[model samples]
Target: MRIGFIGAGRMGAPMVRRLVGAGHEVRALGRSGDARRRVTELGADPVSFTAAVGTEAAAVVVCVFTDDQVRAVCLDTPLLASMPGGSVLIVHTTGSPRTAEDLATQAATRDIRVVDAPVSGGPPDIDAGTLTLFVGGTEDAVTRARPVLECYGGPVLPVGPVGSGQRVKLVNNALFAAQLGLITEAVRLATRLGIDEATLLSALQHASGASRAAATVAAKGSVTAFNASVGEFIRKDVAAVRALAAELGATMGTLDSAISAQFPDTERKS
Candidate 1:
């Protein structure tokens, strides 16, 4: 399948490489010259601009950050207007379900098929080509997308109709936030009880209570909560989940409690 990719940040860059390696015809867009070079190095054609990528590929996959960023790229890129009818657009960002649904509606009006197919697994996971993608769209659309999705992911499970992917992603992120909270407390307790952090982690990994978040915190330690790229990312993701929960008129109990512990003040200090 012919694929187009937008955003070549940490997550986006590796994903494009995987698709290219999978032997798909890939066109990619990056906001920097270095990113463009990286895409080309991966054996995929690098488009000069976001607009160029949108117009050229049969399917466009967005892997940017945030809901607003995704919206700006799609609406302002002008590639949507240039893409031919019957093209497919897939959003891979972890954002609000409403944003995905809105984009799908807009794409549909232009004779484009759109779906929310947000993904999990970190950059390392992407490189391994074992990422899990949760899809939100019609059953047919999900089935049609599986082959292309398989190029970059595993288990392309259907979450629901348009935007359901984002909804599910939100829940996933929220759970991560909560899990981090649990592990943090567990470590604090363990340390207080004369157990070392490494020892605590080794035991947890073998125990039934072990989870991905727990393992991450164990590997990263308390310091990663304040530093590291993923620390910032998780803070934003937790916030996004909280804001979405507020909009949905639901309480993000575990997630909210988790966010309070992790990033009480995440203003990105100047």
Candidate 2:
């Protein structure tokens, strides 16, 4: 399939490589000089971010930093006109599902297909095609999205109709943020009680309390301590989760207060 990608950054560049390696023709653009070099350097059909990726593409992939970034490029772009009816436009960024629904409503006028298809796992998994992807759209749209999704991940499940993917992905991130706090505090308390960091991690890795993040923080403790600046990232994710919770009339009070109290402003790594 011929693919056009908007936004070339950490996640976007690697994804373009994955698609190119999977034998798809990728027309890519970057919003900055550094990003442009990285994409073209990796053998993609590269252009400036403003270059129109007008829709000869079988699929157009949108990956940007924020929800607004996703809208500015995909929803606001005139490329939707260049797209022939029935071509797929998949959103890979995570935000409110409302945007997906709104875009789908707007795109339908042109017969353009839109799907909320946020990815999970990490950058390493994206490179290895092992990320767990959640897709939500019409059953037909999910079916059409499968091939493109497989280029970067495994088990792209159709969870529900449009925006469901965003909901699920948001919850998934919220859970991780919640867990990070629990695990960190558990370890901190253990230390206060005189348990060693390495020992605590090793035991937790095999215990019922073990978590996906436990192994990561354990393996990289020294680095996580010095470089991970985890507190700041926790703030960003906590913010995303909190916004979603508010939209759903759920409370993010505990999560917010804990992070505000525990994580200092200077130490944020994401």
Candidate 3:
């Protein structure tokens, strides 16, 4: 497989490395010299332009940070236009479902398929080949993308159609944020009862309230420390979910309140 990749950053660099190691020819887009060097270090051929990245590639994988970057690269640029017809566009960015739907509509004219394949887990998961991918696309499109996705993903689940992957990812993030909020309350309650944060978190792992979030905070020894590491990303995902809920005329209800407690001011500014 000839693959085009963008955003060779923290999460993406490992994916590129895995794809290259899987014997796929990967062209990674790197706009700067340092970026090019990083891509080279990952064993992927470096291309300076978006158009160059997608040219002649069977699949173009996008792993940019935010929704705006996804739009700028996939919509505002000629990368999609330059991609070969029948190629698959796999987006691992966690953002609004509408973005994926819109991209699919746009790509349809050129015969390119778009898959909203937002990922869960982290760079370590990719390295271990256990990254969970919530994929949304047509049967044919998902089939075309499976081999490439499996290079790094463990459970590459096809949840539904074009935008469903983003929808699932947003909900997953919202729920995870809520769980963190609950953990925060638990820690506070433990403090009031003279049970230290560390002991409470550790004990919870054996209790019914145990969760991946709880385990993470327990490992870090405090919710504050855990938040320090992933607060930016959690806030970003929470905000995206809030915006999506608003756009759909839906309500997050208790989930929103819990997330708000954990990530205050995460609401998208209009």
Candidate 4:
């Protein structure tokens, strides 16, 4: 595949390497000299602008940081128009479902297909080709995009149409945040019961309470350290999920309570 890539940053950089290693010809968008150098180092040809990424590309992957950035890159640029009629546009940012829907509508006019594929896991996961992708798009669109995605994805689930990937990612993040909240409470309980945090976490890892979150906390050796490392990203996802739920007149119920309790700063008061 001839691929166009945007946002070849921390997470996106690893993906570019994987795609290039998979024998795909990748052109990554690099707005600055430093950025271009980084892309070149990743073994992907560096392009100067967004439209250049789409030119003659089989699929253009947008792995930018946020929803607004994704909008600025895809909707606010000529990238889609520059793409070949049958090329695929794969969005890897986690954001509003409506964003993907809007992109899909816009891309349809140009005969480009859009896939919302918000990812879970980090650079290490991408390096291992085990990153989880919650994908949403038409079957044909997904089929076209799969080879590109499989270069660095594991458990590449097809959730539903256009926006479903974002919907599923939001829910997944919310639940994960709530679990962190529960872990916080468990730590507090252990403190009161005279059990050390490390001991409790270690015991829980072998019990039914074990989870990826628990294992992560164990590795960090404390809830505070673990939260400190991932708090900002989780906070961003929690906010997105909250906004999405409000737009749909849905509620997180207990999940909301737990997340708020854990990350009090994220709680939006009525």
Candidate 5:
């Protein structure tokens, strides 16, 4: 398969490597010399955005940051215009559900298929081909993109129509953010009771209250340490969730309290 890829950063680079290793002809959009070198090192043929999508391809995978970047690459550029009729555009970015729906509508005019295929896990998961994809598209679109998605995804779930994937991903991230708050507070409460941080985390793992978020906090040695590493990213996702909730006139339910406690400033800003 001839594949066009965008965003060769931490997550994107490994996915490109997996595609290249899977015997696909992977051409990546490289805007800078360093970006080109990085993708090349991963066995991709790095090219400009125009060249990447200009040629006929079986699929194009986008793994950029932010909703704006996804729109810029797919809508503001020549991507949708240059892609062939039957090719599928798989978006791996976690962003607005509306972005996917809007792009799908636009791309449909050109006979191109669009799949909102936001992924979970990190670079290591991509390298190991264990990343999970929350896919949203027509049956035909999902079927067409499945084989290529399987190159790096373990479970490619077709949740529903065009924007459903992003909806699910947002909810997933929001829940994770809530879990971070719960786990962090629990650690604090344990400390107040004279229990050691390490000991409390270890016991929790064997208890019914054990969770992935708790494990993550434990691994980092403290909530402060974990937040220092990923708080900004989590905050970004949380903000997206809050925006979507407001747009839909929906509430966050219990997630509201968790987000408020963990990210007071962000909650207030939203």
Candidate 6:
């Protein structure tokens, strides 16, 4: 399979390496010198975005950040026009569900298949070929993209058509944000109770209150430290989920309150 990839950053770099290691013919588009160097080192041929999309490939994998970036690269740049008919475009960016649906409609006229295949886990998981993929697309599109995805993915689930992957991912991130708020609040309570933060976190790890978010807070030594490190990214995800919920006429209820209480800065940004 000839795979054209974009956004060879921390997460994308490892995924490109996985595809190359799996013996795919990988060509990557990187706007930065460092990104180009990284993908080149991983055995991917460095090419411009225009060149990458223009070339015939079985799949084009996009792994950029934000809905705006995704739209800019795929729609604004009009990469879909250049992609060959019957080829698959796999978007790994966590973004609005509507983006995928809109792109699918646009791609259909060109006879290109669109797959919303947002991923979970990080660079290490990609390197280990154990990242989970929440996929949404036509059955044929998912089937066409599965082999390339399986090169770096664990369970590649086709949840529904078109935007379903983003819908599920938004819900997943919202729950995570809620859990982060709970974990931060728990840590604050432990502090006021005169209990050691570490001791409390360790106890929680062995108790029913444990969660990945709790462990992340524990590893960072405190809620403040954890928030300082990942608050912006988490906040971005929370905002996306909130916006999507509003668009769908769904209520976030306590999850919305929890996010506002825990990450007030994000609420202000919104």
Winner by lDDT = 4
lDDT of 6: 0.86
Ranking the candidates on lDDT from highest down gives: 4, 3, 5, 6, 1, 2
**Candidate 2 — what's its lDDT?**
0.75
Preferred candidate (TM-score higher): 4 or 6? 4
Please give the distance, in angstroms, between residue 206's alpha carbon in candidate 4 and its true position after superposition: 0.7
Summed over model 3, clashes come to: 0
Off by over 4 Å in 4: none
Computed on alpha carbons, the lDDT of every model, listed in order, comes to 0.77, 0.75, 0.92, 0.94, 0.88, 0.86
Off by over 4 Å in 3: 268-270
| Residue-by-residue lDDT tens digits, candidate 4, 163-237 | 999999999999999899999999999999999999999999999999988888898989899878888889989
Which residue pairs come into collision in candidate 3?
none
Per-residue CA lDDT of candidate 5, range 36-106, in tens? 88878999998966545547988998988889999988888888888999989999999899999999999
Model 3 residue 119 lDDT score:
93
After best superposition, candidate 2 residue 87: deviation in angstroms?
0.8
Poorest lDDT segment (10 consecutive residues) of candidate 4: 261-270
Q: What's the true lDDT of residue 163 in model 2?
A: 93
Distance from true location, Cα of 235 in model 4, Å? 0.5
Per-residue lDDT over 226-251 for candidate 1, one digit per residue giving the tens place of the 0 to 100 score: 34647777777776777777777788
Root-mean-square deviation of candidate 3:
1.3
| C-alpha RMSD for every candidate | 3.0, 3.5, 1.3, 1.2, 1.4, 1.7
Q: Better model by lDDT, 4 or 6?
A: 4
Worst 10-residue stretch by lDDT in candidate 6? 261-270
